[model samples]
Target: MLVKIEGIVIRARSFGESNQVVQVYSEHLGKLSFVARGAKKTRSRFSALTQPFTIANFLCFSSGNGLPTLNQADLVHSHQAIRQDLLRTSYGAYWLDLVDHLFEEKEPNPGLYRFLKTAFDWLEQEKDPDILTRMVECKMMAAGGYRPILHACAQCGSEERRPVTFSIYQGGFLCETCKHTDSHAIPLSDATIRILPVLVNLPIDRLGEITIKEETKQQLERVIRSFLMEHVDIRLKSWDILEQMRKVWAASDDSTST
Candidate 1:
């Protein structure tokens, strides 16, 4: 039975001679891998539709086989700008890598699909791609059950407190009383504790000209990094590359500021 699905190409890699294995995050069918026969050829039927970030409609089927086999594909969203820019591509690839590595196959995530599609569009016009990427991470975390309890202390359920520690081990804020629970809890500024919930709730597209301090961004990064390490349950090589690119971007920014 041929199944028609709309999805974004999260990954496409060489399988055998003149063939490719393509992974797509479909809104209706979740993540699925299809073998694109002869996709490697320049004039192959799937030549353009088999690459990462290409949103397309696919006619595919799994005939009791290891992977679904694609019959035909048509491009839906070109996403040409992301591919043409290096920094935008880096962050965009980071998003794709996170989805490919962290998410489970055949798990329908419509909310995530919408969020991802919108975020990718924003990446093309990303004023600060790193910050945009961080926003994406927060949204994905919320969608993936890793949302941190920033509103109140995760332990005592008390709100509006100072000197709270963000406990990655405990999965949220730790009040001074509950701080003893996790020795590894990192101290968060009152402002950071206040701002995190905002970021978690904020829409990615509306993040224009809303400048957050560098210190606050770093603080958020540390907290999110630990949260992912503790909960997401996977390490990504793309994360390391993103970090290296971030350093280079930062150094360039610093030099231009002087």
Candidate 2:
């Protein structure tokens, strides 16, 4: 049987000297794996279309009992700007890894596709990496149906000014009373909560217009890391690299301050 789908290449791996195994997170099929023949050799037709982060239209054929093989693929958007930049490359890998782990095979999810496309477009065009990361996290969280509640306390009914803590067990922000009850709860700020919705709703083209303070950006990053650690089941390589990057940055700042 032959299947056609529009998708972004999330992962690519070498199968043999002449063929490669590729996994795409598709708009129509959720996640699907394919074998692309001779993609690594020079002047391959499927080379551009099979690379990670590439968006393309693909024709695949399967025996109805085993893995599919790519018959033809046409590139729609390669997003070279994002693939070339060092900072953007790191973030792009992180984003795709998260997507790959969270989504299931052949499950149709239009919202997830939209989020990935928009996020890549933003990272390709946006000047600031901080805003891009924030926007990605907010939308990805919402699309994944794991967004932390920012409006009300997860434990208790109070909405007033109160110490906020995140309950990985409860899956959102908690009130002072809840924090007092649990020792594992992590602190969060009102500013981080306020900025989240903006990231969720705003378009990628407009992301550069919003200026965020470094402190607020760090806070948001921490909140996102904690949430992913609790919810995402798969271990991510890019996330480990990102954490090391942050640690290095923090150590440098400490030394400079001293």
Candidate 3:
């Protein structure tokens, strides 16, 4: 079957000496894996289109059993700014990895596709990548059906709780009354708690309108990481690299401060 679709490149790997195998998360087809012939060659037409994070329109022939063969590709957005910057690339790579793991092949999710495209646009425009990443993580969790309950206590469903903790195992916040339900629950600051739902549902376009304190952002990161670890089974290579880069950046900052 011949199909034309708009998609973002999620994964790309060398197949043969010259061909490349690319996995794209399409706006209409969800995720599709296709082989781009001679894409590894410097002069190949598909070379740039097969790159990670590139959003493009693709024409392909699917056999219904094995991988599809990419016939032609036209660039919509190369996201060159993101590709050139290390920090943006790390966040972008993690988002792609998360999407690749969260959805099944050929399952159309137009909502996710739109969200991802917007995220890339913002990242390229120099939005705070850390905040953007956190927002995307929360949104992705919600899309994957692993949304953490923050509106009320996950245990008793009460809205009048004074102090609450985040429970990864229980899948949400626990009121002070129910804190004993999970001894492992992480204590959350009022600020962090207040921002959780906002991050989960905030429109990407309005991300610049709000500012998050550094301390609260760190707390939210830990909570989101723990929640994802408890709920999602996928491992991300970009996350490890991003952590190492963060450590190096911290060391550099410390040196500059001293």
lDDT of each: 0.84, 0.78, 0.89
Over the full model, what C-alpha lDDT does candidate 1 score relative to the true structure? 0.84
Off by over 4 Å in 3: 256-258
Ranking by lDDT: 3, 1, 2
- Candidate number of the best TM-score: 3
The residue ranges of model 1 lying beyond 4 angstroms of the native Cα positions read 160-163, 253-258
Candidate 3 residues 1-258, lDDT tens each?
999999999888989899989999999989889999999999999998988899999999988877889999999999988889877788899899898888888888798789989999999998888898888888888888989888888999998885479998998999989999999999989898888888888888899898998999999999998899789966788899888877887798999999
Candidate 2 accuracy as lDDT: 0.78
Scored against the true structure, residue 6 in model 3 reaches a CA lDDT of: 95
- The true-versus-predicted C-alpha distance at residue 73 of model 2, in Å, is 1.6
> What tens digits encode model 2's per-residue C-alpha lDDT throughout 67-101?
78999988889988877865577788888887777
Model 2 segments more than 4 A misplaced: 159-163, 200-206, 244-258
Clashing pairs in 3: none
Task: Return the TM-score for each candidate structure.
Answer: 0.90, 0.85, 0.95
The residue pairs in collision within model 1 are: none
Q: Give the alpha carbon lDDT tens digit for every residue of 102-165 in model 1.
A: 6788988888898788888777765767567778888878877788887788888888554479
